[model samples]
Target: MTVVNGYEQSDAEKKLNILNLPSLADEAKKIIPTGGYGYIVGGSEDEWTLAENTKAFNHAQIVHKALSNIDSPDLSTNFLGIDLKTPIMMAPTAAQGLAHSQGEKDTARGVAAVGGLMAQSTYSSTSIADTAAAGNGAPQLFQLYMSKDWDFNKSLLDEAKKAGVKGIILTVDATVDGYREEDIINNFQFPIPMPNLEKYSAGDGKGKGIGEIYASAAQKISEDDVRRIAEYTDLPVIVKGVQSPEDALRAIGAGAAAIYVSNHGGRQLNGGPASFDVLPAIAKAVNKRVPIIFDSGVRRGSHAFKALAAGADLVAFGRPVIYGLALGGAEGVQSVFEQIDHELEIIMQLAGTKTIADVKHAPLTHFNYAD
Candidate 1:
C-alpha cells in the first residue's frame, strides 16, 4: 500500500496507476486477510482459466495508428440508458464490508466521484437504499439474484425502483455460487459482523454458512422464475454471466437490455472461456438489439482496449477495485477508476483513436467453443 497523504502505502509502488486498478496482484493480496482475500482473489483449481484471463490480453498487440490526431480522447458513454463520464463502471462484487468497514457506501461514493455507475449486488453488505443515498442517488444499476420466492424477488425489484436505481441487472450466471477452490480449502465465507447479514435474510429464514451453530444459505430459484423477475423489473434489465453466444442470444430473446459476458473472473466454472474470447461472437449475435458488456481479467488500459476492439460496449474489473477499496477506502477506490480511465485515454491516443467511436471494429481472429 503506497502511502499518499495519510493513507497506508501499498508496499510496492505501481506504475501506470492513474486508475489504481491493481497494476499488480500481490499488492492487492496485502490489503485484506487470507480468508477474505482468498474469497475475492482466489480462482478454481489449477487456475488455468484465471491465468488465461490475463494471458489472453498479452496475445493482442495494440495496432497504434500514429499521427492520427490522438489528442482529446472521449472516454464517456451511456450504459443501459444512463450516461457515464467514462465507459468504465464498477462491476458488482459482494462482501464489500469485508473489503473495508465503509462497505458499499464508500464504493458508491467512489463511483459517483468518477461519474460512473456501481452495480449493487444482491449480496451487498449495505442495502440498496443506503447505497443509493450514499451515491447521492446517482444513476445506479441494481444487480439481482434469483431467490426462491417470486414475491421476495418482486419486493427487491420494487425496492430498487423506489430507490431510483437506473437499471436492474439479473445476474443469470450465478444460478449457484461458483466453485472457489481456495474458499473450500480454506473454509472461508467472508463473514460479516452480526445483525447485518441476519437483517438481510432474517425475513427469509436463513443464517450464516460458516457459523459453528448455523447452516448454509441456499438460493433456490429455477429458470422459469428468472424470466418472471426479468419481466417484473421495468428498468433496463441486463442478464449477467452469459459466456456462450447461445446463452447471450437467449438472454436477449428473454428480454435482456444487455448481456454481461463474464465467467465470474474465472472463479466459477474454472476452465471456461475468458470473457474476452467469447465477446466478438456474443456482440455479433446481439447485433445492436441490446448492448454487450465484458469483464473478467481486465486490469489495465490494454485490457479495456482489447475488450472494445473485440466489441464490448462497456467493461469493468472486479478484484482490482476491491483491492483499492480495501487498501484505501473511497479515495483508494477513486484512484483505481482514475488509473484505468487514464490508461484508457493513453491507449485510445496510442491506438490512433480520438473518441470512443474511432475505437470500433479492430479486426480479430476468433477461437470458438461449443458450450
Candidate 2:
C-alpha cells in the first residue's frame, strides 16, 4: 500500500483505470456503501432538473471554425486573480468522507497535482487547515453555508483566512433540504463526522437526518448576509446557487466579487430550469461586472466549451470528482481532471480556438426545444 494525501492506496487502487470522468460513478457505486452512493448521485424530487442539466448542453452547439492555425490550444486561465492551468475546477461538495477516508484532503492534493482549483465545503469532513496543508499551497476557495450563529461564521471565516484560502463561496439557495426521495427510500444519514461543523453543532448529529441538519441552518439569507460575509472574511465572495439574471445582479450589488451559476447539481430544486439554460441571461445581466463560475451536469470537455461560449468564466463539477476519489483516492481524482483537460484541448484545437478568450467569442447555434 502507498500513502497518498494521508490515505493508504492499495496496489489494486493504484492500477485502477480512470480515464473516463462520466464512467467513474459506476466504478464508485461498487465500492461506496449503498446509502452513501444514493446521497452522492440522487437529486431532489423527480430529478427532472438533474436529467436536464446535462441534456441542456445538447441544445447549444458550437460553431466550429475552419483553417485556423491553432495547435496545442492553451487551457490555462485566471479567475478572481488566481492563475489556473485549466479552467476546470472542483465544485464544493459536502461530507466527502462518504466517498473516501481522506475526503477533502485527498481532493485538495488531486486538484493541486493537476494545477486546478478546489472549493472546500463548509460541511467538509476534514478541517480547513488540514485540507489546506494537503494542497500544499494550491489555490482553494472556502464555500460557506452560513450557519445561524454569527460567532460560528466568524470562527469559520478566520480559519479559512488562516488556511490561506483564496476566496469565499457563499451558497444561498439550499436554505432547506430538497425532497430527495432516494434518501427517503434508503433511509440515508450522514455516516461520518463533519469536522468543520462539529464545533458549531448543538449536539451529536450522527443520528440526525439531512433535513434536520439543514433546518438548523439560517433560512432567511439575504443580500445583507452576502455583504456581511464578504466584509468579515475580507476575501472575494462568490455567490453560489444563482440561476436568475436578477439574482445575479443583486448578488453583485451586495458585494459579491463573483457570481456562481448553479442549481446545486439539481440537488436542491427538482423542477427548476437546467443551470446551463439560464447562463446566457445571467451573463448578459451581469455583463462582466464580476467573474462567473458555472456548474451542474458539466460532464464533458465539449460541455465546458459550450458553457464558456455561453458566458462562464470557469466551469466546475462535483459528482465526477467524488467518484474519482472513491475509485482511486487522490490519483483517481487527478485522472478525472486530466481526462477532461485533455478532451478540452482536443475540442479547442478542432474548434479553431487558441485560448479560453477565443472560446468566449466562438459562435454557437442554439437549437429550439420544447420546455
Candidate 3:
C-alpha cells in the first residue's frame, strides 16, 4: 500500500477504488458523533438550497476541446496576491474540533502541507494565534463574524493581525443561523469551547441553543462596517456570502479587496440560490476588478472547472475537508485536497484547458431548469 500525505492509497482504493468524497464522508460517519456529524453535513430548514448547491452544477455543461496538445494541466493560481499550488482552498467552517481533537490547528497544517489556503473561522475551537502557529507560516485568512460589540471586533482583528494572517474574510450572510432541524432533533449544543469567543462570551450559554449564540452577532452589517474593518486592519477584506450582483457591487464599492460568493453552504438561508448559480452574474458585475472566492456545494473537480469557467477565480469547499479530518486528522485533510486536485487535473486536460487562466475561457453551455 502506497502512502501519500499519510493516507494509505490501498485503503482508499480498496474502499471506493478512489479517494471519493461521499465514501470519505461515509467513513467519517462511523466515527463522528451523531450531533457533530449532523452539524457538519446538515443544512438549514427544508434544505432546498443545500440540495441545489450541488445539483445546480448539472445545468451547466463543459464542452471538451480536442487536439489541444496539453499533457499536464497546471492547477497553480493566485488568490488575493498569494500564490497557491492549487486553486482549491479550504472554506471557513466553524467548530472543526467537533470533527477532530486538534480542530483548526490540524486543518491549518494540512492545508499548508499541500500549498493550499485556509480561512479560520471566528467560531473555531482553536485560537487564531495557535492555528497560525500550527500552519507554520502558510498563507491564511481570518473569517470574521463581526460582533455586535465594537470592542470585541477590534480585539479580534488585533489578534488576527498579530497572528500574521494574509487577509480578512468578512462573512455577511450568517448574522443569524437558519433553522437547522438536525440540531433541533438532536437538541445539540456545542460540545467544545470556541477559544476565539471564550473571552467575549457574556455567559457560559448552558441550556441556550447555538442559534441564539450566533444571533448575538451584529445583524446590521453595512458597507460602512466593511470600510472600517479594512481601514483598521490595513489588510485585504474579502466580502463573503454574496448571492447577487447588486451586493457584489456594493461590497466592491465599500472597499472590499475581493468578493466571496457563498450561501453559507445553505446554512444561512434555506431557499436562496445556490452559490454556483449566482457566480456568473456576480463575476460579470465585478468585471475583473478584484478576485472572487466561491464555495457552497463543490464536490468534484469538474465542479471546480465549471466554477472557474463561470468566473470564479478560486473554488473552496468545507464539508468534505471536515470528513477527511474526522477520518485521518491532518494527513486525512491533506489527502482529501490531493485527491480533489488530481481529479481537477484530469478534468482540465479533458476540457483542453492548460492553465487556470484558460479555464476562465473554456466554453460552457447553460441549460435552464424549471423552478
Candidate 4:
C-alpha cells in the first residue's frame, strides 16, 4: 500500500482502498461532479449491456490446482512488442480531467508508477505530448478516433509519432457517440478543453462527413480505411472495438497488428453482448495471428484471469482507474493497479501457474450464476 498526499497511508492502505471496485465507484461519486460521475459510470440506454458486461464474468469460474510449483509467479508480458511489467494496462477513457484536475497526465504517471502501459485517448483533456511527457517516456499507446477531417487525422498520427507512442489503437466503436441516458439526464458534457485537437482546429469545423457517407449515417469507416491506417505509419496499428469474429477477421485482414475486444465498455451500443461473452470466438478467429487486448467489465483479478483464459493477450482497466483518480490522484490510481496486480498474482499462485502464458491452460468451469 502506498501513501498519497492529503490522504493518510495507514487509513487508505489498511481501510479505504481495501474495499472493492464498486465501493471505490461510490467514493468517486462523492468526489466527482454529478454529471461527470454520471458520464464515468453510465452506459447506453437501459444499461443492459453494461450490466451484462460484468455479469457475464459470473459464468466462468477458475479452477485451482494443488501440489504444483508455487515459488514465484511472473505477471509480466509483452503487448505488441512493448515489455510491460504486468499484463494489465490502462484503457483509453476520454475526458479524464472530469475525474481529476491533472487528467491524463496524472493517469500516465500512475500507470508508469505501477509498471503498466497507458493508451491515451485522442479526446483527452491533456494533449498527447503532455501526457507522454508526464509518463516520462513510459511505454504508451495512442488511441485514435477517425475524425471527419482526413488532414486532422494525419496530423494526429504525426503528433503521436512525435510523442514517441509505441503503438496506435484506432477506436472503431465510437463514430457518432452513444445515447447515454446519464449524460442526458444530468446534462453532462465534456468538462475540459481538448487541447490535442488545437493543431487541427476541429470540433466546430462543420465537417458533415457523418451523414454524407453510407446510408446517410454519419462517418463510415471502411476496411480500406483500416488498411490505410495500418499502412500509414510504421508503428503497429491495433484495431479496437472489435466485438465479433467477423470484425476480428476483417481487422486482421486489413493488416491490424492486434485486435482490441471491446464494446466501447457498453457505452456505444445499448444491447450488445459483453466483451467477455464474445472474446473466445474472436480470439479463436484470430488464431493467434495477432495479440488480443480485452476491455469492458473487468473489475477483479479473477475477471482478468477469465479474460486471459478466454484468449485475451492483455487486459485493460478503465472506470476503475478513474475511480482511483477521484479518490487520491496518481497515488490512488497506482494503488488500484497494484491491488489488482497483487490479486492476480494470488490467483496465479493458487491456480499453480508460474507465468502469464500458463494462465490460458489453467482449469476453468462455467457457472450459470455468481458464486
The CA lDDT of each predicted structure is: 0.72, 0.88, 0.86, 0.81
> What are the runs in model 1 whose C-alpha is more than 4 Å off?
1-20, 193-207, 210-226, 363-371
Residue 314 of candidate 4: its Cα lDDT? Answer: 94
- Cα RMSD to native, each candidate? 5.2, 2.9, 4.8, 5.2
lDDT of 3: 0.86
lDDT-better candidate, 1 vs 3: 3
Better of 2 and 4 by TM-score: 2
Over the stretch 1-371, how does candidate 2's per-residue lDDT look in tens digits? Answer: 44433333322234246556778788888877787789899999999999999999998888877899779899999998999999999999988877887888988989999999999998887899999999999999999888788888888899999999999999999999899998999898776667777787633345557887786688889999998987887899999999999999999999999999999999998999999999999999999989999999999999999999999999999999888888878887888898888889988988899999999888889888775
Better of 1 and 2 by lDDT: 2
Query: In candidate 3, which residue pairs clash?
Result: none
Residue-level lDDT of model 3, residues 1-371, one tens digit each, is 33322222212211112357767778878777787788788999989999999999988999988999888889999887799999999999998877877778888988998999999998887899999999999999999998899888998899999999999999999888889999999888776667777677533333446786776689899999999999999999999999999999999999999999999999879988988989999999999999999999999998999999999999999999888887777887888888899998998999999999999999899888774
Off by over 4 Å in 3: 1-18, 202-208, 368-371
Ranking by TM-score: 2, 3, 4, 1
Task: In angstroms, give how far residue 174 of model 3 lies from its true place.
Answer: 0.8
User: Model 1 over residues 1-371: C-alpha lDDT tens digits?
Assistant: 33322223233222224434555357767766677677778787778888888777765566867777558789888776778898788898876766677778888988898998888877786878888899996778888765554555666788788889887877766655555678777777435633223334433222333332122222553345446666676677778888887987777777777888888788767778777777778888878788877888888887898888887888877888878777667777787888888888988888887776667665544444333
TM-score of 3: 0.93
